[model samples]
Target: MNEREEDLRVPLISFLLCLCVLIGGIFLFLYLFVPNLSEPWFPPIALILIGFPWLLWVLTYIYTCIKRCFGVSRNNTDSNRQISRRASTMANSRMARNASTTNGSNNAKEKQAQLGSASLNSSHCSKSEDPSITSSQEIEMPLTTSAPS
Candidate 1:
């Protein structure tokens, strides 16, 4: 009932009518002109009639896939711009935070210490890395042996 649905309805109905006309015309031609056609010729003629629409649909699908792979869609371009904008905003926020922290009168040694500690604390543990173990110091392992029979 809405404008969008009504717009789609007209085109859809027209397409179906055109398809019906095409199929009907093909059958009518085959019936009239190929009345004495042999069995061997019948399958090829029928296949050609049926396959035209199928071929068109397949070609259209492939064209759309190729276009999508090449990033020709407007929606894809819009999403890329949005992603870059968000990344830039995050970087700007981080820069502002760093500027605010270093604005104090702290000397080089104190500033370096504060920055180092902040970095160490701010670093998050990834899913694959354990948070409980902080140091890279190697641990001694006990040697395993089979019990004497």
Candidate 2:
């Protein structure tokens, strides 16, 4: 068998063995102590015996799930903070490089000033426009059907 399957085999076999033992013990206990199955207390006692282990297992599973969720969220927040730091550092370095390059060139400065002014003008134009009318309404395209040759 493969390494992964071999690793799983031991745990799987142990779990099956434990289950078999549990079932055998329960049956043996019921047979030895409770001969009368129809007794009022027998059913509740049997149910409790069977359900208690399952209840413990379910509670354990839920606790693990809650722990996993918190762990994942914690990891995500840590990763996000790392990514934000990296991005900010990269942006700062790029800005520094641009500043250094622009110092030697008048053309670069002129281009930067033009881009800034263009952005300002665009922002102003957007602010002056009526909010009720959308860009889609301002520009309309005509629909045309292709004629078969």
Candidate 3:
């Protein structure tokens, strides 16, 4: 097949072989120790030190290889970039909506996309010392209330 597929397959197969060797080594070590018939030097200390992180390294290698096989090359770097992009998009939309609402006109919104992109500045934010509000502006209300017959 292709070189890319070949590259992935090679590492995956190598890791699988390493994993098999790890399993066999563990079983053999346990079997030898459980019997207690072997000499003190039967299981070496070098093996113990190497064994500590060997499985973890092999598993990671195999995981990367399999992921490459499936064409999922995404990593933490891409994740960070995607998250930042999404955050910026959300912030932009929120700003646009707030600008449109404060200005109050659908036609104006359609006409001035650039103007609709105003940021929520300090001038737009106000604090009220009074809890309740009063307005002198009068509005026309329904003169009669109707109920379904």
Candidate 4:
């Protein structure tokens, strides 16, 4: 409540004060400056019909200008989102590059692991075969297996 009072109360009070003053000034002008036509209400009514709408247009233009200056426009929001997305993409790419650069042993370890796995598979295959091992073990195994079956 206190914060709302501080932020909104003062401004709202000032706005209402100024609006009252403006209405008073307009009434005084219409009463004094504008000459009364033959009819009692025509001149005052004409001023209201013309000046009030024109005043509304001018206020609308000023409001749009202020909104643009504050960066609350739609284009500003879309552009800010585009910038944020690009920044995140750039951050991810930089992290990937940094990781690859700092870890020099990663490639060597990967290659060693792959070679060890291949040799382990060959050893398993050889153990499963129970025959007299020869120098031409691979050739003999394939020939014997294919010839019989």
Clashes of each: 0, 0, 0, 0
Best by lDDT: 2
Q: Please provide, for model 4 over 1-149, each residue's C-alpha lDDT reduced to its tens digit, 9 standing for 90 to 100.
A: 44434677767766765665566556656666775623456446556644664676699899979978985666665465445444444444444445445656676455445444543343233445342232234333221111111
The ten-residue window of minimal lDDT in model 2 covers: 140-149
Candidate with top TM-score is: 1
Error of 3 at 103 (Å): 3.3
- Candidate 1 overall lDDT versus native: 0.51
Query: Which residue segments of model 1 deviate by more than 4 Å?
Result: 1-3, 8-45, 73-149
TM-score of 4: 0.28
Q: Which tens-of-lDDT digit does each residue in 1-149 have in candidate 3?
A: 74445577778867776766676576557657766654454356436544655666789999879977786454653464345444444555555566566667785465346432332221122334221111110012111222111
Screening candidate 1 with a backbone cut-off below 3 angstroms (N, C-alpha, C), the clashing residue pairs are none
What C-alpha lDDT, on a 0 to 100 scale, does residue 50 get in candidate 1? Answer: 61
lDDT score, residue 107, model 4?
Answer: 69
Q: Which runs in model 3 stand beyond 4 Å of their true positions? A: 1-41, 44-49, 75-91, 94-101, 104-149
Off by over 4 Å in 4: 1-38, 73-75, 81-149
Candidate 2 vs candidate 3: the lDDT winner is: 2
TM-score to true structure, per model: 0.31, 0.28, 0.28, 0.28
Q: 1 or 2, which is superior by TM-score?
A: 1
